[model samples]
Target: MNYIYQDILIENGDVVLDAGRNPVLIQDSAVIAQDIKHAIIESGLSVALIGEKSRDGRADLKKQIELLVEEETRLVPGTVTLEEPTLGNIWIFAKTREFGDLQFEVKEVTN
Candidate 1:
C-alpha cells in the first residue's frame, strides 16, 4: 500500500484528506523532517493522523506530538510496527464526534 495522499480541506479540527496511492516511507534518509512538517503545515493541518493496520479504528485521528532535539516543529512519533501495518497511508481523525468512519483521499504533491 502506497502512502500518498492530498489534503483538500482542514478547518476547525476537521479534515477532508483526499487519499489515494498511499505515501512513500521516508525513514533514515535525507528527506528533511521539517520539510515534511512544512508540507503538512502548509496543507493546513496541525495534528497528524495515526491508525493501526489491524485495529477497529476509524481513519480520522488527531495526534499531539512532541519535538526532538534537532527537528523543528513536531511530529507524530513512530511506534512499534503494526502486526500487519501498512506504511504511509496514515489515517487521520478530529474526534470521535467530528469525523467518524471516514478515509480521506490522499492526492499527490506535485512539484
Candidate 2:
C-alpha cells in the first residue's frame, strides 16, 4: 500500500494538524479515534491506529490502545513497506485531555 504521511498535534486538549485539511469537529477523543478507525477500514488501508501514551499516570494506556485497534489490525510501527507514495484522506483523532501535549501521525495508505 502507498501512504501519504500526515502529522497531527494536540495542544491544550484539542486536536490540530500541520496540514490544511479540514478539522474534525468531534471533540471527544474516543469518538474521534473511532472515526479514524472507520476511515482506515473503509479505505482498506494497510495501517494501524495506535495510542502512544496518556496524561493520567494511572490511566491504562495499554487497554485504551487495545480498545482503539480492536481485533482488526496489529501492524507495528515502521514495519509498513510502501511501493509508491500516493495522496489520500486520512482521518486522525487525538486527545490531550490533561493539559499535556500529544502528537500523532496518520499514514493514509492506498491499496
RMSD of each: 15.8, 16.3
Which candidate ranks first by TM-score, i.e. highest?
2
Best by lDDT: 2
Please, what is the TM-score per model? 0.20, 0.22
Total backbone clashes of candidate 2, pairs 3 or more residues apart or in separate chains = 0
TM-score of 1: 0.20
Q: Which stretches of candidate 1 lie over 4 Å from their true place?
A: 1-31, 47-111
lDDT of 2: 0.36
Residue 81 miss distance in model 2 (angstroms):
15
Give Cα-based local distance difference scores for all models: 0.29, 0.36
